[model samples]
Target: MARFSYRGRNAQGQEVSGDMEAGSADLVASQLGSQQIIPLSITETETLGARSFKFDQLFAPRKVELDELIIFSRQMYSLTKAGVPIIRAMRGLQGSARSPLLADILGKVGDELESGMSLAGALQQHPKVFGAMFINMIHVGENTGRLDKAFLQLSDYLNMERETRKRIKQATRYPMLVMIAMAVALGVVNFLVIPSFSAVFAKLGADLPWPTLVLIATSNFFVNYWWAILVVLTMGAVTVWQYVQTDEGALKWDRIRLRLPLIGPIFERIALGRFARTFAMMVSAGVPMIQVLGIVSRTVGNRHIGAGIEQMRNGVERGESLLRTAANTQMFSPLVLQMLAVGEETGAIDDLFEEVADFYDQEVDYDLRRLADAIEPILIVALGVMVLILALGVFLPVWELGSVVRS
Candidate 1:
């Protein structure tokens, strides 16, 4: 008999731990199950011929690279769909993994499986890479014997998320570049060009035009107190950062962000996309509806939307239909509520949510592109107007000075 140490939750939901002798880990688990204890971990106690240690195992945290996880999910789904045994598919993945961390995890999972652990149980050991949502979905798939389908769905979801984020970043790139360029241009004019102009006007010993005088005063202030400006900026940024760390401040700020013009709609669409897609995935994966709502609410980045979802969850828990709760929230669009109602009536809520997600994802892409297009012309016009004003301010005085000299 092997000596096994186990940690489990008992019938009363209290944690229990102890050592027991059993024929195998499965036997130990079975014994625990009979005692109404849900075993979380069970490790065998082994006496080695010599003390041995694997430093990698000791320090290894279950971290799989994002790209590696995506590729592994796709490959595993393909292999499993082609009728490869789970263990064999895992072994192939383990052998082919370029990431040492992922490879080690796969190897450990295989070893645990060989010791009679279920796939979901083995995966749960690597919580860093596979979160509770991912693990729960896999467990559901295992129970339903649709592991390949589950992996395919997860891969597709992740791919969509990655692509959406990429598009968002791409859409914002030009505007960000323009803003940085503007800052650099203004900084150069303020620090270097303004000082030279100021010296020239001062030496000319003439009364300056109103615009030039104002500009000179501004430039002198910046030049003489640049250190004070830097200190103020640093302190302001630190204050904002500290305020954002507080829950109340963060919630208030997020609410304000969701109400801002031009940007608010884009933020709403992004949050809606995330909520719809995650809820759809969870529902399709056979997670309970309440649990799906709970996860979706937490995952939505906007606190306002998250709070609305929480209210919807409460309504649903009180025996209201999902569509009814969603409609009552008033945060979701009428189209979304109507489609959800239809889905609820027809028992295709998951499909409806997926459609909603797809629609919003496309909308977000379109909005981002439009926002970029709008921002480019607006920023150009604003910059051009500023430059025109600056030109007049500098040249008007110089022309006046020339007139005075000729007179």
Candidate 2:
């Protein structure tokens, strides 16, 4: 497919210009005609250098952030509830959108809507901005004529996800800053402080203790081979990044992340909560159970957990009970499994899933609140050990030299 830029006149004789992906210029014109737009020009967008990397784009705002999506969903809920036409609402939103990319996409979606495409179909064109779950929910809303409710549900879900992320960042910020400060201090001491001390110790020409000797040797190594160290670190990072891009590597790494010390269980609960929340939302929206599992799996944020959800989806497709499949994964706590069983029996699984999500969220919130307190003692021990090592390495030599001079 090729992208074509076009300028046209709408039914009200207003100028409308946008880009669309089409097989040819004729197709683009046909699309405009269906929208009651008279095409003035249709030119294929240049693709010769499109594949090449542009340095400026590195710093560009290419993504629509969560805050923007949340705001959009809320505004959409209000507009739709007020009986605003979808095309006009989208055009109005385009003008008010903070992100230029989102504004442009909204304009294109409006164009698509004007061409008689369904709202969900119009949104499906921008996969990068509108996820599968988003499109599916919108499609369900369009069919059920409950678009406002759909947007409201999405707004609530996104808000919850955002809050969870904020809490996680808050919990980890202190530890992250401490670790970074420690790394910077270690570098300065190794390359700067230790060398100056080593020079004085060499001038004393006294027998150096092993601690001082080790410090001096380490400083020399860092100073002399800093470039090699940088190169090796960069290469390792690149290798790991590339590896994580592959399906198997990504799954393995995600699994390993959930096994990480200190924050592992927190991450696990977060993922499970997301899964349950998303599952509940989809099911409540009247999506099929199998499709709900499929969508929830992709949105779960952890590939290992996603894979387990995929297994549940497969089990359900094969006629197995939801509780049985969930139990088989062994990823859920007994309480959660019991909740699933009750939900299955009562046939109010959507409500039970919401409860399950709440249960996980409460656990996650408690953990995040105490995370820093739990980590502080360990960080203090580490910092103290590093200070003790440095003090002994630098000062023990000075004390020995003083004793020798007195003797």
Which one is best on lDDT?
Answer: 2
- Per-residue lDDT, model 2, residue 116, is 54
Give the Cα-based TM-score of candidate 2 against the true structure: 0.89
How far residue 206's Cα lies from its native spot in candidate 1, in Å, is 1.3
Residue 390 lDDT, candidate 1, scale 0-100: 84
Ten residues in sequence with the least summed lDDT for candidate 2: 45-54
Best by TM-score: 2
Scored by CA lDDT, what does every candidate get? 0.82, 0.90
Per-residue C-alpha lDDT of model 1 across residues 1-407, encoded as one tens digit per residue: 55678887877887767655566899888967855679999998853333477887687655676678789889988987899988888898999999888997898788756655567767865667876556766777788888898888878877876787788789889888988998888788878887798798788887888888878888889889999999999999999989988988788888888888777888888989989988988887788888888767766777778889999899989999888888888878899888998998898999999999989998998898898887888888989988987897789888978987898
lDDT of 2 by residue, 280-382 (tens): 9889889899988988888888999999999999999999999999999999999999999999899999999999999999999999999999999999999
Shift in Å, residue 290, candidate 2: 0.7
Assess the local accuracy of residue 57 in candidate 2 as a C-alpha lDDT between 0 and 100.
Answer: 68
